[model samples]
Target: MATTKTVDLILDAGMALVAGAGPDGASVRAIADRAGVSAPAVQHHFRAKESLLHGIYARAVDCHLEVTAAALLPVVLPHAERVAEPARQGVIVEMATSVMQEWLREEGRATLTSVILHLLVHAVRDASYGDLASRWLAGTVTAFESVGVAGTGDAQFLVELLIGAALVSAPGRFRCENDILNRELFRSACGARDWDGGFWLERYRTRHERTRPDSDPSGEGEGLYARLLDVCVALTAEVGADALSYRKIAARAKVAPSSVLYHFPNRTGLLMALYREVHRRFMLAAGTEEVEPRAQAAPAAGLFAKLIVDEMAGEAPLFLTSCELFLASWREMELAPDALFMRLERGKMHGVPQLSPSERQRAHLHSIWSLGLALTQYSHASSHRSRDVELRLRDGMRFLDD
Candidate 1:
């Protein structure tokens, strides 16, 4: 039998290894070595690699919930009896901003979040993992609720918003200006009035002005490049970028292995190119100008419904590949900014010029909300039909306003 201390060592080793090098570097043998145990000893504790990964993720979530609750309980407890409902709402807003600020200021927090995101990517693709992810999310929301976020919907939105904030503000890579937007978003999540802070929105320039895959700067290798990227996208959506390789792409695309290398040169470049392509596709999907929130809730709800249905129907690979790569890119130092940019300035917000100022602001929020919705849907491992997904999306879009 494995001692509790030995199991803790194994779990800690797995978390640190995954945080540093993602799932690819966190093999059972590697974990055992890091834990100063034999491989068989680690296996005796975890049973299998999947079980070990689950243990690591579950442990991380437990620590996160404990820490967050500790930070929030003192602040919220005093107000629990003293405040009226509206005053308590104010307290929730204050705590929401405090949570974001504390999250941003904490040292080594991003490392832990990066590990969670990696597991979250796995959850997006694997149904069993998705069930674990869903439970983690529910547990997290419950933690927030215990600390004063009263409504289930409000608590859920804040949790999702924080996840986006963590991803966009990767360790030491996020822009300082964008921090304002996040704080404002935290307030908005708690039903606080919108802050007049659109300056940060203007600072984030979209990397590619054109959101078309065919609009590559170098026109050379158009046919083969597109074919290779298509294969990479499919593969990355299915298994994630860590498992991707030139030979695998070649085999899938029916191109020579050398050809993929010629176009991409390295895995980092290949992943970035796929990120760009995926970003472009997402832009097109979200570029529905006909659906304006200010017009009424129906059009906006319909747009989100379409997007979610497309994701569930496998018509849009963006929901799968985009978030997966976005999380995975946190471990890739050179790719961090590009990933942050994709999260910070989702391609849709830049192209839509018809929105009013507040609408534009809400558009940015809606984009993040949509990403969260996709994450939530997949985390629950829903096998809903398009109509079911559409119905759920319609209900979810009520969160678009503050």
Candidate 2:
């Protein structure tokens, strides 16, 4: 029989492997070997591969939640009590930042990294977990709202940033010229205008509404390219970017599959084009006009953050596809520089600024942090709390001040 200590040893070994090679590498025999136990002994303790994975997943979630709750509890309690002192609010943020930073240091990283990666790599299997995370975050936000001390970022948004920061910053994940991408995304974001924040809604009748075949006997007309892109966007939302296929896009577009190839050439090309369109729309909706190349950063960043989160909540599937592509870029060597370049071009088209290296780095961090916010809010279907969402964005825009 495996002792409690021995079980700990087995679970630890399994986590180490998962972190290094992801979920695919954590085979039972491999776990057994790593744990220095016989295969049957490993099975005796965990009867199935899935059972073993669940063990690790639960363990990681518990550890993550415990640390999170500890840090958030103080702030939440005061908020729920309606403590509304400005001084207290400042103190609470400082204390919360300190506690959260502690987790980013040393052994805390090791403890959290495996779990975060596990969550990301096997995100599909654990759809329900995201809901739990959403509820946990909302509670934290509500706690703060109840208190008079208003926080710029809600608990859920803050933790979302933590998970994202932990994942990419973890040594195991690939790092790229994110600062460059950040500048472009920020610059492009600044180029547009007109912000309406909502979730899953239809726009008021546009001047050029397309006519469906039943209505006009023509077809969904005047927006074939736009319609096709919308289909791609919707497809990404439904099946995720990983499963996005040309055949699927064609079927949804009601175009020939070969026609998709005619326009896109390949999967990468299709995705790149689709994201460009999506990003363009994002910029237009997020911005009104460009400022003096971030002569001021916070105001501009705030606008973009608010816009991004609004869209994320309403159009999560699109953002999830974007997330999928973002991860894909990290894994595909040939995709590099192109992914960053395309983003830069988009920004230039919308007119992004020429940022200093340091400034660009700050902007990149801002983009990453924002993505984390979106990932948390939209990736799961949970109750929407608009106040908390705004708090998350305001807090994240702080990175722009650097």
Candidate 3:
């Protein structure tokens, strides 16, 4: 028992170090010192530093899976009712948002996500680790049924989206920009007042119309919408979600603010177009080739990861727009059911290749796990440092045929 306790202690210390310093910071000697154990003793259980790190990751993944499951428990009934009554979608959304916020508030939740994300990146190269991750993902999706969001695809997307956000923000070590955006996102999710789509649109259109376009020789209006989106993507990648605005986007696109408004009309129009464009680009990058059953599943999973990485790495505008959309959807769930449903459906469908009939029964559970894990990874990549994210994402695509 004492030996077991010591091993656990060592793992805890290692996770703490990784959480604080990122992957580069957690060393075996440092872990030993932090755990109050001798270096050799640490080596005894872990065998090597890599093994120790993996162990920490495994434990952290398990802990996050548990917390996520607990978070879903309170909303199961409402989720079920939402299936029959479309009007109840808002209730379901609120339930999900509340559960996630509660989970974030729990102690050590942030570090746990960071460690899990780091491990997931490594898991791509290690089949045993991958299987462990797969199992956890499966379990998380199953837990979501208690709330009523049924399809595996939807479950998967939700898990990935949430996990991606967490990975971007990583709980405790939140950046100022992320904090502001996340707080707004949380409010939007909870039916709070600040997330009003009308208000945002009004603000964007009013500001955009105030500026004049330059008399460039080229008929710049031809591709103004596309150019603006590109600029938004660039801005979003550099900063967190808070940096998106007409002035910022116009400055980056080298267009007059009025030009932007002329094409987009209002913030709502701009945001809707941007969101649709992102979806289109994401699907294009994801490709449309039908895969053989043996390989069918890989493309969706890889696509999901790529869609997230591209958005997170490129700029803040797209993500900022995403947060606003999330809020907008929450405020007016009925106004955009298709969009919400599509997002949910995409997540659930991404994991279809890996499950069988029996496993399919557990699809929602797996979806949540994958989503949670994905979110953790995205959050870390956005907010923390982990060399393995790109490699791991690459590995996730290996099953695809180019």
Candidate 4:
């Protein structure tokens, strides 16, 4: 007789496994074993592995909302009518910002976020799982509305940006850019007017770093090396990083398994190579110079937004694969440092002309928001995909004209 307690225990065990090792770790039998229940019990509760995965995410999301209750109360609780709109909005924005900051800084919440993202990455390919992901995002917007923030484009992007930051950027780095990031976040979250771009421009100029990936050694034949990378990228985009095996790559490339290993000795090396290759493809596809640290001249403000649209239209597999890798970096500590650099490097500021400081900042900001948007929307129907990308591009371009 499995009670509600039995269901909770099963969900707890599933989340722990998935969070630590991704979707592959949370097998039905394994979850049941961890929960000290028979495999039949897990089946009885969730009915299938897919349902169990969905259940894990639903539980995690509910727990997140539960914990967030205390922080949101400053805005959630009713206020006096005498309070000015600006003052009340300020409290709401402040509370939202604090809650997001905790998502970055707090260990328990961060782990839960990782679990959510892990399942989300799965949802990109799994239609059944995508329903839960969609509901979770919509519920977030509704949650924001309850706290007085309107469901404007900026507010939507702010939610995406916070989710993206949790996916890729480290907590310390999020704190480092807190002031600049929050200025932008507050504008979007609370509908505040835009401010000076000088602080962001100066920070962009001084703080951005460039480190090139290791060049492929020619001893193993550069052609073979490049071929291996192409296969890895395609497979990763089709399947996922977790499902990638050396045998799989070799089979696709029609090369010996040892040859694949000879060129790339480990999973980390292969992933790093894949990152550089993906970066090169993005630069070339955007009509920017691939080898340079910055573009020849700054691209137009909405250029990256257009670039995102194009990628979704044509190169969706690659785009989603990049999203998977970025999120994976957050969960895998050894990969975090280089992956962080790779992510920040994608939003270089030096090459564009007459670019306003705000535009430059928005360029970087939109890049993050795009990651979140693509993750959540890519699994939808084709018509919705086009509409969402267009809306995202429109919302992203709004700051450029200022």
Q: Write the per-residue lDDT of candidate 3 for residues 77-98, one digit (tens) a residue.
A: 4455545433444554555565
* lDDT of candidates 1 onward, in order: 0.67, 0.51, 0.51, 0.65
TM-score against native, each model? 0.86, 0.52, 0.49, 0.80
Model 4 steric clash pairs: 297-351, 298-351, 298-352
Winner by TM-score between candidate 4 and candidate 3? 4
Best by lDDT: 1
Winner on TM-score between 1 and 2 is 1
Q: Give the TM-score of candidate 4.
A: 0.80
lDDT of 2 by residue, 37-60 (tens): 888888888998877876776666
Please identify which of the two predictions, 2 or 3, would achieve the higher TM-score against the true structure.
Answer: 2
Compared with the true structure, the alpha-carbon lDDT of candidate 4 equals: 0.65
- Model 1 stretches astray by more than 4 angstroms: 81-90, 101-108, 175-178, 188-194, 206-214, 266-269, 291-295, 312-317, 347-351, 383-392
* lDDT pick, better of 2 and 4: 4
Give a tens-digit lDDT track for model 1, residues 283-400: 5675756544564666666666676556421233456776667666666767766665566555244445666545665666666666666676666555664555455455555654
C-alpha positional error of residue 283 in candidate 4 after TM-score superposition, expressed in Å: 2.0
lDDT of 3: 0.51
